[model samples]
Target: MNLTLKIWRQKNANDKGKMVDYKVNDISPDMSFLEMLDVLNEQLINKDEEPVAFDHDCREGICGMCSLYINGEAHGPDRGITTCQLHMRMFKDGDTIYIEPFRAKAFPVVKDLIVDRSSFDRIQHAGGFISVNTSGNTIDANAIPVNKHDADKAFEAATCIGCGACVATCKNSSAMLFVGAKVSQFALLPQGQIEATDRVLNMVKQMDEEGFGNCTNTGACEVECPKGISLENIARMNTEYLKASLKG
Candidate 1:
């Protein structure tokens, strides 16, 4: 296959970025999207031109480090998959693909396809964990009986990989869905109840402080989420926040 790639390029965070076009030929349909990029980089290196920089690690799609805005979609035209998992076969021969970094105020561009996602780490630090005794008096987690349905839902919410696709896809750049998933992961479990009130409050507070926009119920975040995290988590988070506010 012959393809034209219009990819964003920026030297540094402060540099104004622009799209640059390049062509790749004889690309195998079996190659993953990142593999195709590798071919492009090889061509650039042989020509003595700088290679396009993009974020990718664990191309298996579990790490969620491969974030890209392809053809105006968060993770390309495919559904429920990260950019790394995207296959070259999804595109046709001679197709022109537009690739850009995930854009959001909280996710400022760092380079060509890399962005500062440490904002997510800060939000996680705010309250994405549970307190556990470490002095050899810890209770067995398996001993605590959890409702089957709640356990399933909690696992689903915990699948969120902290990818910024939700923020990029949202028109308002709202992070409510991401925060909600993080909150729900703990809210449904018995171990998390101890910090329930503080968890929701602190996480939501941190999300806002990071310059993320408000959620207007557009539901685009869930649609673009690679994990298919449900909107019900957002509703659950809102309820948790309300209860926490009332208790305070």
Candidate 2:
């Protein structure tokens, strides 16, 4: 199938960017979205033009690096899949596809579809890990039994890949879902009890410091999340945040 692509082109973060039109032909329905982009880049290179700069790694959709706002939707028109997991069959021949970077104040445009998502790194660094004794005195993993329900919930929350789709889709550009997932992953585990109070506090503080927006219950974040990170995680995070605030 042939397609028209209106992709955002920016030389650098400071440059005022605009959409540039291009055409691709003979696209296969079996091709993943990134594969289509790869074809497009190849065409550009053949013409001695600079290739479009997009991020991708582990294109199987695990790494969450292919973040694109396609046709006004995060990760294209699909549900519960990242851009890398999206297939060209979703579009028809001669369709016009608009591709742009994930937009958020914290995620400033770097170049073309690339944006600075390191804000997420700062938030995670604030308090995403549990402190443990490294002198070989750690408790046995089997000694403490966790509730099956809570363990399942924690595992679900742990699937978040920090892709910023939540932020990109949210009207407020909130990181509540992503941050909540990180907090819930640990808050449900006994090993994370040691830093529960400080973890939520510091992470939330850093989320705000990074210029992420507030959660207004729009629920778009959960829908676009490739991992299907539940809104329950956000609720859990709110409860955790409240308890931490009261005790602090």
What Cα-based lDDT does every candidate model obtain?
0.94, 0.95
lDDT of 1 by residue, 1-248 (tens): 99999999999999998999999999999999999999999999999999999999999879989999999999898899999999999999999999999999999999899999998999999999998987989888889999999999999999999988999999999898899999999999999999999999999999999999999899998999999999999999999999999997
Question: Which 10-residue window of candidate 1 scores lowest in summed lDDT?
Answer: 131-140
- lDDT top scorer: 2
Q: After superposition, how far is residue 9 of candidate 1 from its true place, in Å?
A: 0.3
Model 1 pairs in collision:
none
Model 2, span 1-248: residue lDDT tens: 99999999999999999999999999999999999999999999999999999999998889989899999999999899999999999999999999999999999999999999999999999999987676989868669899999899999999999999999999999999999999999999998898999999999999999999999998999989999999999999999999999999
Q: Which pairs clash (backbone N, Cα, C closer than 3 Å) in model 2?
A: none
lDDT of 2 at 235: 97
Task: Report lDDT (Cα) of residue 184, candidate 1.
Answer: 100
